[model samples]
Target: MGKILRAIKKIIPEPIFDFFSPVYHWILSLLAAVIYWFPSRRGRMKVIGVTGTSGKTTTVEFLYRIFTDAGFKTASLSGLWFRISDKSEPNLLKMTMPGRFRVHRFLYEAKKAGAEYVFIEVTSEGIKQYRHKFIKFYAAILTNLSEEHLEAHGGFENYRRAKGETRI
Candidate 1:
């Protein structure tokens, strides 16, 4: 199944893929959620979403420390890396926000690790791609807003709206 999916992904032209990416991503996000058993609510963990033009990663790291210090089993996902309980590793993908499947997998792993809470660094690009879909956040922290990734997000307002979607 994985091989076939990979092959199909490679066969799709970049231009065509980009044009249809929104719907494609939305469907894949939904599919991943179903396969992962709806990670947003399945783990019984409180998910905290942190978003902003800058400092999201740092904030996630800080929250991770705070949660761990408070004696709660915690997990965190950011562009830098991800931590599940006491284990940690680097995110070599170079993507601040990976696809929904990867996020679901991480959440599922965190749940299996008995995490009481998961802190996530949300990005405007990620939200636009629906990468934050299916994650039920208990709280959302907006560090600050600014004009960044304007071209990718189509404008400052669009970028802002995408980031705002994480709160919902």
Candidate 2:
């Protein structure tokens, strides 16, 4: 599946792909929300987003413990792994951020499990690919800026802007 997808991507003109990327993601995000009923719609769960060049997974893990210890049910999505309340697992997707549907699905599970907070590790690449779409974040913590994902974002400044978008 991955191989085929990559081949298809390679066939598309870069400019055309770039132009449609946002629209593709936006439609999927919205479609996923509609099918799943947008778990964040009720406003009961607060998503705490963590984005940066490094240490995002660690930060999310730390915040998860804090929230859990403080008696709030916590869920988290990190590059290293993900957790739903007390349950946890390794991140098998390889992608630091999961795709549009998985994101909403995770939130649905969290909401169903009565999670009060979900801390996510946001990435510049993830944002560019629209993996950060649709979630209503209560707060965003930016650890720092670096020259990471420069090629993906086209330059350092663009990289920073992509990371910064998580705050919005």
Candidate 3:
């Protein structure tokens, strides 16, 4: 555990780590609640999950724009930004996967923001880490598949299973 902590400290940017401190504990609490209560149930918010090697961000943005244009309160978490009900803020964490419980916290925030729809980009690593285990998605979009993350996935079939099988 000490070695892992030291490695994380060495790798993560100081500013990013500092920014996460306050929200980090709050997020953990939310994660615990979600795991304990709604482990297999979808919370009140309607979830839309987008996954693929590419276009996940674009698709999420497009959906967000559509929902905002339709005058419905919506929240979205993608590679580009974290949006809450027509208001968007940049995600400076610079992390593809923001820890195990960040998604649950994002959903909770969306609920507090009175969002009727929530959009998320589900990454392969997130799936592998069981980060997507608890949330239930109403719909999912797969843009395309490609030879990416071979080093992490070990093979193309495994990569595809990580990204594609989530739709099942």
User: Which candidate wins on lDDT?
Assistant: 1
Q: Rate the local accuracy (lDDT) of all candidates.
A: 0.88, 0.84, 0.76
Point to the candidate with the largest TM-score: 2
* TM-score, cand. 1: 0.87
TM-score of each: 0.87, 0.91, 0.76
**Cα lDDT of model 1 by residue, 1-168, tens digit:** 559757877999878877887897799888998998887687479999999999999999998999899999999999998899999999998888877889999998998899999999888888987888888899999999988889998898888888889964
- Model 1 bad stretches (over 4 Å): 1-19
- Model 2 residue 130 CA deviation (Å) reads 1.5
Q: How close is candidate 3 to the true structure, as a TM-score?
A: 0.76
Kindly report which residue pairs in candidate 1 clash with one another: none
Please identify which of the two predictions, 1 or 3, would achieve the higher lDDT against the true structure: 1
Candidate RMSDs in Å, in order, are 3.5, 1.7, 7.6
Rank candidates by TM-score, best first.
2, 1, 3
Cα lDDT for residue 5, model 2? 61
Quote the lDDT for 60 in model 3. 93
Q: Give lDDT tens digits, candidate 2, residues 31-54.
A: 877777888767689998898898
